[model samples]
Target: MTSLAPSGHLTIGEHQLEYRMIGPSPAEGPTLVLLHEGLGCVGLWGDFPDRLAAATGADVFVYSRAGYGGSSPVQLPRPVDYMHREALDVLPRVLDAIGFRRGLLIGHSDGASIAAIYAGGVPDHRVRGVSLIAPHFIVEDTSVQSIAEIKTAYETTELRTKLAKWHKDVDNAFYGWNDAWLDPAFRAWDISDHLAYIRVPMQIVQGADDQYGTLKQIEIAEAECYCPVEALVIPGAGHSPHREAAEATLRAVAEFADRILNGHGEAAHGQAA
Candidate 1:
């Protein structure tokens, strides 16, 4: 397949998602598919994708899901199973559309959970491993509290104004994620079953000071996954470790991608599931 442009829109179903491609094409080497956080978009990723591609010597693809960035705006009040739908429905089409031969899925927050679900649910042998930053396996009271506070901030403060620089329809991106999580039915949302079924190595990076979730999220991965699970906890960091601890986060993620994509992946992974 030919290499993708530096940036463009991908028409998936009715949605036209925005994306940026860096480094080699999938045919040249491995690829890294970055799934952004609930409110994150391709623009919000900044130059992290460039740094990652340079560090790993692999293609880096960053995209904004529906309702975020320049992507098509989704209907408000996304389903409680929104992340699940992204993993099982949207992400696969994305990977296929890009002609991804083999690679890693690096995700943040909600994106991390979706990566977990996809790696475990899809039978695609092309995906080598997963790198999760501040992943959520199950909902927590603290998570709810933090999200509520953010909602308050978005509504009363300039958070929406700041976020508007990224999303064309900011309210759709904000409420789509905020409303679903705050919904009472979403409290029971647990994706641990997906963790148990993952057959590839998994690396989880977390912020020690993350208010949205606790170390219990990593504990769940350790308990449920039969595959190798390595945790990297960054001190004095919160929710988005990649931003709070930029250099360290980039190095760690790049190293993990290198290890897994190269022939040494299996040696580090132990027994595959």
Candidate 2:
């Protein structure tokens, strides 16, 4: 149940990323890597990381990507392929730098997409399972509309001021994600092809009332992925289930991680009939 402060930094390429570690040491049980959402960072995760650690007894490694929190800033107008680049390029290095052993990826929104891409693209044996919260597998009108609404809020409301507290370069953090999603070409952005390649068990958690995405995201996983896929739709929760419905999300994630990492079930592979 030990929670360590996020006083560590790792150099990935030219960027300095800020991260926090909780629970047992790396030599202990499997690690849970917490990947933040589009506008999220290490600080934005609040007490969820600590609670997850205490509940599962697994080391939780949470980090702020470039241009967010205390991490290095990035150029504006990020490419629409940013998530793909992060999953294929940056995540592998981060895992290596952290000496990642056996692990499970717990990701939210943009972070969840990255985890899905990585699990499908890389042949890393260290990744045992994936828990995706509010993940988007395809571009939907609802997601775009929500992103547009947030953009307006950022410009006119206190959202920008609130986010500034978490991001060192708030504009870069916001615009990078906002602009990419709102771009006309991004409407065709889809990661459903990646799901077919994922070899590990996966748990997809989404809020029943998630404004940013629809249940179609989970349906794609069930239809495409060769691995076992479980879906949870929490009522009264929105896009950020881990934040909106913390207790329920924590219980589901903790149980799934325990089962996958502790060898409590049969292997999860092969296409569904």
Quantify all predictions' global Cα lDDT against the true fold.
Answer: 0.91, 0.89
The number of the candidate with the highest TM-score is 1
lDDT of 2 by residue, 1-273 (tens): 233344678899999999998854554567999999999999999999999888877889999999889999988789989999999999999888877888899999999999999999999999999999999899999999999999999999999999999999999999999999999999999999999999998999899899999989988999999998988888889999898988888888888888887755443222211
What does candidate 1's lDDT look like per residue over 61-163, in tens digits? 9999999999999987799999999999999998888889989999999999999999999988999999999999999999999999999999999999999
Residue-pair clash count for candidate 1: 0
TM-score per candidate = 0.95, 0.94
Candidate 2 scores a C-alpha RMSD against the true structure in Å of 4.1
- What clash count goes with each model? 0, 0
* Local distance difference test, candidate 1: 0.91
